[model samples]
Target: MKFTKPFLVLATMLLISSCNSIPKNQEKVISLKNAYQKDFYIGSALDTNQIKEKDAGVSSLIAKEFNSITAENCMKSMFIHPEKDKFDFKMTDNFVAFGEKHKMFIHGHTLLWHSQLAPWIAQIKDSAAMTNAMTNHISTIVGKYKGRINSWDVVNEALNEDGTLRKTVFLDTYGKEYLTLAFKLAAKADPKTDLYYNDYNLCQPTKRKGAVALVKNLQKNGAKIDGVGEQGHWNLTSPSLDEIEKTILDFSALGLKVSFTELDISVLPNPWDVVGADVNQKSEASEKMNPYPNGLPDAVQIQLAARYEAIFKLFTKHQDKIDRVTLWGVNDGQSWLNDWPIKGRTNYPLLFNREFKPKSAYNSVMSLKETKK
Candidate 1:
């Protein structure tokens, strides 16, 4: 069928408009897990709601983006072993089952921590009693998930900012032996599972030295430690890229793998000069403190993107030494930062927004390798 001159002209115009609508670069967007699969595991911490799959959107995002999972609260001593004699594995079991269903690496957070100690365990004053408590707790928990859980934070935040061992109930009662004892117990319970000493402020020279000393002490005592976790609870600035790179290299030099567990970059003004992950610290909320009550501005979003890009670039550079990078939460709305430092403040921290959609930071991190190539 031959078209008239006007009909032919209109068809040609229509075809040109359709071609313009299609993007010139049609590269597919990669999932977080797939983007770094060859380098290391990409993970996220799951709360109770997420574990139970209460929110389908959150669950779907987690399955698609992360290849590893950590229980944000349930696996801690406070929740898993609430009572001295009673062990509750309700939520903990669900957490493990979810990870297994997705074929993700399951990380058990905090076999021993000072902050969330059970009241009964904290009240025990006798060294023998504390030893039994520590042994029982570590053995029972670790043994139960012996082959299932891939790794554990055997000890968390045991060092003070000055790099000395913090005087906790464990340290006061069991002395420095508690560190080695916990690791030894975990190693005995699950010989195949990886054990790590995790802490915050590890980027600081003093604290980094403390960690190195602690690791050496554990080694001297014949404790089996596989890696060290530097809790990446950072802000928009501070903890310079050089400090982070040094921390990774220093830990790697110890012949142990490095992981950025609890990774989140807060884009908010810290109330104090030095930022920390101390749960006890609190600041009264004010209008100035809660700058982005509605949402982050475009300029601030751009800055966040750049910050994530720089950090991921460093991670990609030393991918061989790193084992995993786990985000603290799945999205900004669920981030613990919202209530930390200053309560009731809106904070944008993670790569995903409140709606479980990728933010500028997410795109920046995902495209890091692409830009290099």
Candidate 2:
């Protein structure tokens, strides 16, 4: 009974199911035409199989609402290189095509990360070869997507939990020069691209200090750093609202564009249960995943809505400093929350409910216009 209208897909699916008029389920999809004004990229962590020309699952939601897209996996090093000495654009090209077809702003996810890199990239321990290879890779990817991507998360998760250099191979081989060179190379390759530094725990003072210092060093070195992407992968109660607002202010104070690159709030049974002894030590991917309870009763769904209201209220309070807000996944079924942090927790922390229906949280975000009322 929410204020939504039946989308074409739902109508079609219903017609096929019963050969009649639209089902009542899609009545809440009110025409969001011009619902958003700012050119911010409201996107998800993964694009799903939409690139494969399928219109089901996460793709449907993104197609319905978003005007921008970020490849959660396509731009990563591992997907680009499952084997060394052979780079494949097979999957990446599909993502690029999807972006253009939808006219969605294409955001290249990452240029460097300690994790998710190919084993071969890790083998380049020497400075000369490492630097050359890095340069080549950056040029190829950025150049390939020149004038294509809306922006790029030029670097991802470069700092540790405590804000220290993560001892990544790029760090060992090239040091701070690696950071500068990567940004510079990306700029030279794609002069129109927006380059950024992406990281997590950025709200923590320790990590915040490290990130600020890194950006400061890069600015001093004449690097053309365009933005800083705060990976908004946060929990329910941690990273206080004050800290989140202050973090944006501090980063924006540096005169760099700021955005939330991969954001998701997990409503776990216990937010602190994934630490130390409670952590899942499983090695196999299957052992690490289990079905989320999906048993969040109706009342709890509205509770989720209030939490979203508070967060969006914060966003409205500081809209000037924020460039974009991206949810990590489109909906519950595809969210990394099911297996992330603890590997098995039924977390309902997004706008869309399990039935692909908008929750009260959805109305809260939709009504997040100016927030003064």
Candidate 3:
């Protein structure tokens, strides 16, 4: 109480120094991975550059904030086995090492898809040769990552909008048996890894029915099936909250784990008359379609954040049945939405922005975990 002015200033300086000396770990804020550690994993897909550890910030952010890693494209058929005889494991090996180094759960994107097929497989007319090629391709790839991969999207985008099998080269050659064959082959290669049937727009009635039938048929045929991946490539307005929840519940009813394999919300206008979530669909870029050329407006950003909050809330409500939810890309700039459907358009579909900083959507989603007990 009777201290001199110099002594009072010295005491204040000491207090300030003590406050600033807090340990880095204590000063660190909770990251997405830390926040959702108990509920479920929070993951983002890694493009080529990320897998190679070329971008220091992205690599560091991934190791710091995520518990899972998915190779963006290296595992695809075209990239893995570009020809009938050759098999390339260069980038794929890099991806596996990257994931293993980070101790992240590795999810193999796809084993079978009509698109991204090697030209030789697509050109094959003989059914027997086609079947042999398919078997060899699946066995080799799955065997390479046998115990390493936690899950595999064994088959992708196989159902048409009307609930019938889309006629691809696989189906044309092997009929409905092709689906079963793919699952069986993957299972044989890695009995431990979870085999999944992944597709987009499972929220639609027809696609949902088709998927249910496919899983049931696989079970009946004694094929080792593990899960279904509903690619959450959704929009803000379309695919109502009810429909999305219905899809998750319906898929889980099969006693199989469900995953949001490729989740992204495109904050851009779509071309007229597009009904289903077909990744192959494309339209000419125009002023009307690419409305937010410069950046997302404040109003639109709020809408995007609210949409993400609602989706995450639904996920939290059904965390038991859902195994994992992975964002399609790390940031808006790396999103595939910018190219597909339209060539050179800006789309803010991810939780992070171009600068590798969290957006409003990230905050909204993370707030769920914070407010939880």
Worst window of 10 by summed lDDT in candidate 1: 21-30
Question: On residues 96-181, what C-alpha lDDT tens digit does candidate 3 reach at each position?
Answer: 89889989889998888888787888887767987799889999999988899988989989999878999999888778988888
lDDT of candidate 3 vs native?
0.88
Which residue pairs clash within candidate 2?
A: 4-27, 4-28, 4-29, 4-30, 5-29, 5-30, 45-328
Q: Assess the local accuracy of residue 97 in candidate 1 as a C-alpha lDDT between 0 and 100.
A: 95
TM-score for all predictions?
0.92, 0.83, 0.92
**TM-score sort, best first:** 1, 3, 2
Q: Write the per-residue lDDT of candidate 1 for residues 1-373, one digit (tens) a residue.
A: 8889999999999999987785635545579998788889999999899999998878988999999999999988888898999999999999999999999999999899998778888898989999999989999999999899999999999999989999899998989889999999999999999999999889999999999999999999999999999999998887999999999999999999999999999999888654579988888889989999999999999999999999999999999999999999999999999999888899999999998999999999989755544
Q: On a 0 to 100 scale, what is the lDDT of residue 204 in model 3?
A: 90
Arrange candidates, best lDDT first. Answer: 1, 3, 2
| lDDT per residue as tens, model 2, 1-373 | 4544567678778778785555555334342223444535566655546566576665656777776677777777877865656678887898888778877777888888777787889888789988888887889888987898878888877777667777889999888678889888998999888889988778888889899999998899988888898777665566688888878888999998878877777665433334211123332334224334746667666666776777767876676777777776667766766666556566777777667677777887776652322
| Winning candidate number (lDDT) | 1
Q: Candidate 2: lDDT of 295? A: 67
Candidate scoring better on lDDT of 1 and 2: 1
Better of 2 and 3 by TM-score: 3
Name the best candidate (by TM-score). 1
